[model samples]
Target: MDYESLYKLIPKEPKKWLTQDVISWLQFIGLGQMEQKFVECSIDGAVLEDLTEKDLDEELGITQRIIKRKLLNWVNHGLKEYNEYIKQMKMPNLNNKKQQDEDFTIQKNIANSQFEQMLIENHENNGNDQFTSSVVRQEEQAIKQEIPGFNKFEHQLILQPIEGQQSNFYCVREAGAKIGRHSSNQILILEENISRFHAEIIFQDSMFALKDIGSTTGTFIKILKSLTLIQGMLIELGSNQFSVQKLDLLDNGGIEISLFVVEGPNLEDTIIFQLNKDKPSVALGRKSTVDISFPEDHHLSNQHAKFYLVDQTVTIEDHGSTNGSWMRLSGEGKMSNLFYLDPNEEIIIRIGTTNQYICQQNKMKVNEISGENLCIICVERERDCLILPCKHNATCLKCSKNLALCPFCRVKIQETIRIYKN
Candidate 1:
């Protein structure tokens, strides 16, 4: 429920936030205790922004003066910021029935797929379950074979158009991929705000690295680097997640934060911890050895990710894990064109107003809300390939290449045959 990141993901005029957006903000500001009530009342961003001091006590029943003050302050600040800066970030209508239905489908598919992977991973390789079903052998082999080429794998770049730029994938060879206004670049970004020699996404040391070679506006690649944590950030590591609220800046020169764990059914059974420069690096995973552990979450690797503190800023990095980690990527930051190459992650960067390449599923996962040719899996790119045998035109060339099973029927996919549509 990182509200800022969520807002960055689906930009809208502050007053136009969807219901989901409102829930996220409520959680971030310690107002989540009233989330059920707000949702039951069908309160959306537009309605939330319109609530007044009197309305809070009388209608909303937010009797606490402190709580009422916080709500009013948020509305006033949002209005001030919207009027002074931040354009009407113009994003697609995420609430449309079609869009919501598609999101639900994607969520459903992700859950089912994860469950299938666990079932497959549990099958012993000694042919113990061979006679039971070739399902294990077939799916496991496909996944193993595809894992090697997933990097060389061509994924789509889902651009949420910025006047002139259209969303398209520009595959970067082993050497590197450059993006800018120049026609010679691998990805030609014609946006006026972009510099001529913007930035380069290079594949090095068996991974992708991005470096800005002096751009006027500066290149701000989203994640896979040290991200400065602002107050009220919702950080998620696999199944374990927490909301960090910056408490105060130390007089001696540091920062303190209260980390509140947001999990389980009972809100009353909440857990809170404190973190600061005293703890330089904290490992996070399901293993008891890690600083923070989610023992019950099978999806998390023993050592999944890590958080760091440097110069009053908190940053995060994904450790080498069975499944990669990511967070909501959006908004802006002040970063120079520095080379960023994580041990994990395929190199993908962009120029222009904003790069809508959704964060990988953990957060980096991207999704295209609307488009006639959109892939059913990522839902961001065009449907350009069919699952073998079933031949269902469901996923884009990228997602199609990465699947071990056809998402639609859960059938073991023999191959993804590239197909073109009229």
Candidate 2:
């Protein structure tokens, strides 16, 4: 039969019927296996009034002869059932309607009674005003309690890359934050040198502190000098003995004492320094007073290069060294003679033929190092000093003294004691 003839055979209600109803009719007609194909046809709008038998045959993947005969029988049966249902809905018995109205009213009264009972129970529970007031007061007191050192403004950890002129800032929002290669950690370091769960920055006892969580490489902070204001003057008694008893008064009132002079490494040495907020700028070369001195190298100038932090960005600029300074960026196999670094990248500093330093935002784990004996900074010198706080024995005495921060964890080194073999 044609689509127009088949469509006219179906009742309007059956045309609006669901897929399940169509499936039921298909099963009743002994065509249950073909139900899925018919449902697909319906989804493609094949059940519409404009649908043709040719369209159904192509969509249902069934022959026109079989489908036409099956659909005609299904439609005839559905039309009879649809007409009877419509007639019953339109002419419901008056006796049944009255009975339904009465049943609805009774249900409404029962619901009202249940609602009133719930209200009475709620009122009884709230009658204990004293208990409620005490609970509210306790909550208020807890809110007012002061927590020391948790000044939101100061509680921030910044990871500044030594090579690249980029930094990552993390707000101390929670009690602690984990930093590592693990996906679960708040701060992720994807470098293979970092452990899965490397370290944690915790806010405890009103202080934001960094702790190394048994990482292969340790954590480090930049060492800063503790500044103290002294009111008294100093007297030069003997070489090592300074007698504060003999007060030397100045014209301005009290004389300030200069107990010791903190000097940079000697010119002939290779120094490793960490870039931090307080001391951001560092000069490297043959000068003894340079932040990072390379005194013995003739290829280096009096001031070879400068590594400084500008607004949290670490940048290195060559200062006219005779042999010239070069940098190799992260992931690069060969060292390039690049003058500047890209963002979020690591660079190896090379002066002459020696790889002077590896500049990066984060420290590499000890296990990530190919050799244990080599210094972490120079990579050429034998390691002899064990950095304190995060005890990773990774640098020689010369490199350790010059380092304000540990190369492994980037944490400030409190002290670096020399380790001697017996």
User: What root-mean-square deviation over C-alphas does model 2 reach?
Assistant: 33.5
Model 1 residue 292 CA deviation in Å? 32
Backbone clash numbers for all candidates listed: 7, 11
Tens digits of per-residue lDDT, candidate 1, 10-80, equal 33455555455577677767888988767655465556767888877775688888888788888877545
In the range 11-71, model 2's lDDT, one tens digit per residue, is 2245443344456545555677877776644321114323455655765567758767666
Instruction: Give Cα-based local distance difference scores for all models.
Output: 0.54, 0.43
The 10-residue segment with the lowest total lDDT in model 2:
234-243
Candidate 1: list runs displaced more than 4 Å: 1-165, 173-175, 223-338, 341-350, 359-422
Q: For this target, which candidate reaches the highest lDDT against the unseen true structure?
A: 1
| True-vs-predicted CA distance for residue 249, candidate 1, Å | 12
